[model samples]
Target: MLPAIIASSRIVFADDALDIVQGDRIQAEIDALRMEIDDLRDERDEASLDATRRTEIRRLITDVVADAEMRTNRIDRPWNVIASADGDFTLEADVIMQYDWVLNSTSSEPTRYGFSLDTLWLSLGGTMFGPKWSYGVCAAVGSDGTFIPEYAYVQHQFEDGLFVQAGILSEYFSIEQAINPNEQLGTSLSFVAGQFDAGQPEGILVGRQFDQWRFWSTLSNGWGQSYIDPLENQRTGVMTRVELKPFGDWNTLYMFNPYPGLVDRGLLFGFGGSFDWGDYAAGTGRSISGDATRATADVSWQQDGVGLMAAAYYQDVPVSQTDGGRRWAAVAQGAFFPVSTWDVYARGEWGAVENGSRSDFAMATIGTSWIPAGDSRLKVVFELVRSWGSTADWSVDGDIGILSTDGDQTVFRTQLQFAF
Candidate 1:
């Protein structure tokens, strides 16, 4: 009778394990396991099996169930490659690929269309000695096929709830800048963000999270400088950002648009400032010498399928005693999922520069995105942008790819993105 019970338990274990491994429904597998366990418990007949035999059978069943659950978790998150049995150490890999097509209304600028692997990010990140110590390394290829080192940082979590990160760290000055390009609401970042982008630089960052609020400060060679730039020409500055999350968790707050059936609601308010002193070499022999101060404020809110974000930026750079000066910009954007697989969004921007000419400008953008029901990893976006007012030269501000032009300018963009 004991041998018969053992055989029955083996059959149950084998069938359940196979189902869990092959099926994508985690909750269904869990329910099946529960039903099987209840059936085994009912087989506790005193005449058929002794108490010791029943106890052994239960132990085997528990062990097999645990193994099956672990496998299910691995299948659910394939990117999280476990490095240690205790789960204190882990490794994760991520990739982002974007292909874009653009048509500019300006006669001087030819329509640009092609697969510009603008963000070929191949990154690995994980914990080291323990869960408190972590590191990340990213290598990327730019649109022009240039090898760019993105982020290489090591961070440590102190016992006192404070954290410090050092190395070539990414920017945290603006919420727009912090978001990945592939996740941006528009085809590209706004003109304001492009002008004031605090590019990745070698720096040391310190921060702490208390309840729903957190702040981070980074001291580094200032904005527009990457890790591979010339050290002698670097602009030095310190950037600080603070955030208050009045509602949901951080994960659901960062994305510009909510996924299908997103139930986690969130509200976030953030402010950041930076001051840089020194000369920034603009070109071959042209350089701007002075001190620059910048400040930005932003707010984000999301509930279910609706999302909204607004940000404002101000910068003052007194070069020499004249000739150059200040700039301010503001943007308000919103998105809503009218259908389960479709997202519609719109954005408005206004900006002005204090330089002599008519540098005031405004841009309006409307876009739509589609994500198939079968796969959320792939996204298709189409956006139309229209701008007016006198423009400054694209060289003066890193305008991403769009060229500055006189009169009203219109651009149509289509993008296909995939990530894992």
Candidate 2:
């Protein structure tokens, strides 16, 4: 009986101790759950504060940028002197100057060396009313301080990509003549190219561009005519040109040398023709009667560090004119870069006149150019040109000097050009 009672006491004591341990464990679990809830509330508060700060920062940035854009539409430049607040009107100016030191050795004329101002071009142009309407006036200052008017025209581009301009305009037949003088590959244009180019004329031009194709036609007073030319010497003329760009940007094609960061590869083909008819005296007091027609075809290709240009020209002149006959010419030019900002180029030209004299001539030029500090605004060029064959009875551009001798002639030129 004693043993059984002892056993029962022991069992009851064990049950009480187990109940106390289970209650302590339950209290500890409840405290831990409460702490977790407190941590979640703290995190939520921090996240709300961060989101409010971010919103405020974004609002401040937006306000500052809006104010800046409203003050200046971001198109203002040193050349852009005048502008409208709504970004619809603006005015711009540009200038280019080129100086040359030339040394010539001709068989007939004594070797001579002289320095001359080649070109001083100034332009003022900008958009009016809207981006589609624009006007420009350009002029050149000769070495003798003569004011040579270049281009003065107002142009409008329609939504369908057609444009029309009226005033003093260029012939736009030869790519070499169409490019700015400062951008030419050599010191001067090839002799053959200069012979066929019609110079600038006062006229009306209509043009259209779509995708990779472009066409322009001009009805002008006549070849080599200008605003100041006398009316008695004027004649009716029409010129037309077409261009097809397989690939590449049109603006880049104007430059003979590859510019910095030139990564484009393109091929371009151009063809042009002109006709003039009247019985009038030319500006140079030369008689120009009957009809004349000029035709030209050119191609240009550029890729990587190399560029090439070639052109062929043909003209049919009135038999009444001196040295008049079917004249034809061809020119080819190539350029390559040995390094960025430096270029080496070569050009060759050949032409013939099927007249009483039947003059035939050929010219070759080699040159190198350097752009200091990779700055295209400034350039220095050195060139050596050689001409040979029957050079008599041919008139190249007067500005480049006369090649009188029939024998071979040599010329060396050093040039400095600046543009802004």
Candidate 1 has what TM-score?
Answer: 0.75
1-420 per-residue lDDT for model 2 (tens digits)? 999999999899888889999999999998998888898889999999999999999999999987777567645456446677676787788888888898889886788888888878998888898999999888999878888878889999999999999988856898988887777885677777766767677889999987798988999877755554465764788999999998987877777887657636878899999998876665556667778888999999987678899999988887666545788889999999898879899998888887647458888889999987554579998989888886665666633543666778898998898888
Tens digits of per-residue lDDT, candidate 1, 209-313, equal 987998889988775556535545646888999999998878678888777565479899999999878765655354645688889999999988888999998
- Maximum-lDDT candidate: 2
Clashes in model 1: which pairs?
222-235
TM-scores of the models, in the given order? Answer: 0.75, 0.79
Best by TM-score: 2
Alpha-carbon local distance difference test for all models: 0.76, 0.81
Backbone clash tally (model 1): 1
Model 1, C-alpha of 154: deviation from truth (Å): 0.5
Clashes of each: 1, 0
TM-score of 2: 0.79
